[model samples]
Target: MVENINIRVANLQENYLIAKHLYLMWQDIGVPDESIQSNWLEITKEYIDNARHKLFYQAFIADISNTIVGSVSCKIFAGLYPNIIKPEYRKQGYIWGVYVEPDYRRQGIAKKLMEEAIAYLKSISCTKVILHASPQGKPLYSHLGFDENNEMGLDLS
Candidate 1:
């Protein structure tokens, strides 16, 4: 059946489902190993819940048949690079947790969710929008004006 899928702002009420989807996405990206499954689930839940309260922007969820099949969130922060570099801080946002069900792939769902995230970030006066895109999503983000940059990472363990 061709059902109507609606993309709307995710509320705190949907935190669990959102967290579940995020956990699945992380597994899909090879970031969460089998040994970390339980720990990661708790971490994802707590983080998703906290972002709902702390972030200035909203998370978007695409619901089809009352199931959240796609999700994306933008984080907006008012600060310079690390905020210690300069006192004059501008707003920045990031698109994250972008996922669509396997069966729902290539159906323009991810594009729609990303459009929502971009629009929301822009509405919040975000000067930049960043995301660590998966290989499958790189082309989509590139087509939408996101480019590759030499990004560095640090592991604080």
Candidate 2:
């Protein structure tokens, strides 16, 4: 299955498909439809706009038999703290919206997408990368050498 997969850079024309994959990823992680459906289009539009800007955004898709089966998006971090960090530790890249169709799971498609995203970040001189891993994805990320950070969160609701 992995042998037949091809990784390619995504364009604005594929924004809708990327958005669909993102929605599926969220759903697979148990995000409520009510929360995702209501603003899906807007969110997709924002992705398109960000991708178009190209200052810090890029998306990649996994193609199998000319069909998109998985996707991952990456962005260069523009946070204020990054500006203060040492040069070698600055210019962080963030990976997100990783998804593979149910039928494509366990086929290494996600890994390929991540490799492509990481290569892109490296080409752009990103010194570090980060992602918020879903429970199902933690193992894969860990295998890829991604370490856990000390981020904490609380629900005000």
lDDT of predicted model 2: 0.86
Q: Residue by residue across 56-77, what tens digits does model 1's lDDT show?
A: 7578888887877888877765
TM-scores for all predictions: 0.82, 0.91
As a whole number from 0 to 100, the lDDT of residue 106 in candidate 1 is: 80
Q: How close is candidate 2 to the true structure, as a TM-score?
A: 0.91
User: Residue 33 in candidate 1 has what lDDT?
Assistant: 65
Quote model 1's TM-score: 0.82
Q: Which pairs clash inside model 1?
A: none
User: Which runs of model 2 end up more than 4 angstroms from their true locations?
Assistant: 80-82, 86-88
lDDT of each: 0.78, 0.86
**Backbone clash count, each prediction separately:** 0, 0
Which candidate achieves the best TM-score against the true structure? Answer: 2
